[model samples]
Target chain A: DQQVKQNSPSLSVQEGRISILNCDYTNSMFDYFLWYKKYPAEGPTFLISISSIKDKNEDGRFTVFLNKSAKHLSLHIVPSQPGDSAVYFCAASALPNYGQNFVFGPGTRLSVLP
Target chain B: DVKVTQSSRYLVKRTGEKVFLECVQDMDHENMFWYRQDPGLGLRLIYFSYDVKMKEKGDIPEGYSVSREKKERFSLILESASTNQTSMYLCASIPGQGASGANVLTFGAGSRLTVL
Candidate 1:
């Protein structure tokens, strides 16, 4: 069973526009959510994260919003650049067993067109 | 800057052969993990260790095993390699404690394994 799901397999957006990626989780125990950006031939790097306590978290051009009631989260990148083109993964972890297990979504390929 | 290094970037093996993928982290992190990445499946955890001599099976542990003999190194072993095992393997590390534990997961470039 896939606890975390990224319904969209791919997404395309124009440069200088906002690019939004969505994710949903079936487990209510998950309290921490994170987003990672991965490029070809490279490892996925941390982008932004949101705790269940808060509804949103922002870092520079990236913003992550969490809706606990709906078990949904979204990552928004403002003024998307060509460099933002990559596969984005959404991951969730429950507290107390934080480092022990992390469930990852299938991932969404984001293409920022210049 | 935390650095996670995988011993090999690519490897090829034949069916029934034993394969080992090694990973090392320089940041002295107590938590280490192994994940397999496929085209659309994203990253699925195979195994993880929280300390030296300690290990735990992750979501997908079938046909895979891991070892953490030292504090800085973790190894994933495939007892009998099969064609279906061919995929990109990734290793990650994070501090054992604190909120960053679940937030930051530094990953190695990845090792592409091909089981013929």
Candidate 2:
């Protein structure tokens, strides 16, 4: 069973619009959440993260909101640009494990068209 | 800046052949992980090491093994390469403790293996 799930396989948005990628987890033990972005033939780069203690965290145009009660998290990118097109992965892990077992979602491919 | 380097970017091998994928991290982080990413299946952990000479099996350890001979290197080995084992392998490292409470992982570019 997949502990972390990205329901959408792909998403598309127009330039200068907003792009929202959603992720949900079945395990309540996950207390730390993160988002990573990857381009073709490249490694994933950490984009943003939010601890369970807070509901939201923002980094420049990228914003991550956590809904602990629902066990869901969403990443929002405002003014989405064409360069934002890539696969986004959602990961979660328990802090005490010290990043030993990070559960990653299947990933959502985002395309920002101009 | 922390960087994880996977020596082989791509490789091709015949069935029953032994394969080795090497990874090294310059950050000297205590935790190192080997994961394989497949289409639709996502990143499945194969093994992880928390300390030199110590290793732990992750979700998918079947037909795979790992080695951590030193603090900076982690190696993933395929005893007998099979067609089903063909996938992209990614290596990552993270510190044991952090001020932010959440440790971030630095990833290598990844190694794609093809078992014929």
Candidate with best TM-score: 2
The weakest ten consecutive residues by lDDT in model 2 chain A span A93-102
TM-score of each: 0.96, 0.97
DockQ of each: 0.66, 0.75
User: lDDT of model 1 at residue A36?
Assistant: 93
Q: Write the per-residue lDDT of candidate 1 for residues A3-113, one digit (tens) a residue.
A: 999999999999999999999999999999989999988889989888899999999999999999999999999989999999999999897554566789999999999
Please tell me which predicted candidate would have the highest DockQ against the true structure.
2
Lowest-sum lDDT 10-residue window in model 2 chain B: B94-103
C-alpha positional error of residue A92 in candidate 2 after TM-score superposition, expressed in Å: 1.0
Residue pairs with backbone overlap in model 2: none
Candidate 1 local lDDT, B53-93, one digit each (tens): 98888988999999899999999999999999999999999
Residues A3-99, model 2: lDDT tens digits: 9999999999999999999999999999999999988877889999999999999999999999999999999999899999999999999877577
Q: How well is each residue in B1-116 modelled by candidate 2, as lDDT tens digits?
A: 88899999999999999999999999778889999999888888999999999999998999999999999999999999999999999999988776343388889999999999
Interface RMSD of each: 1.6, 1.3
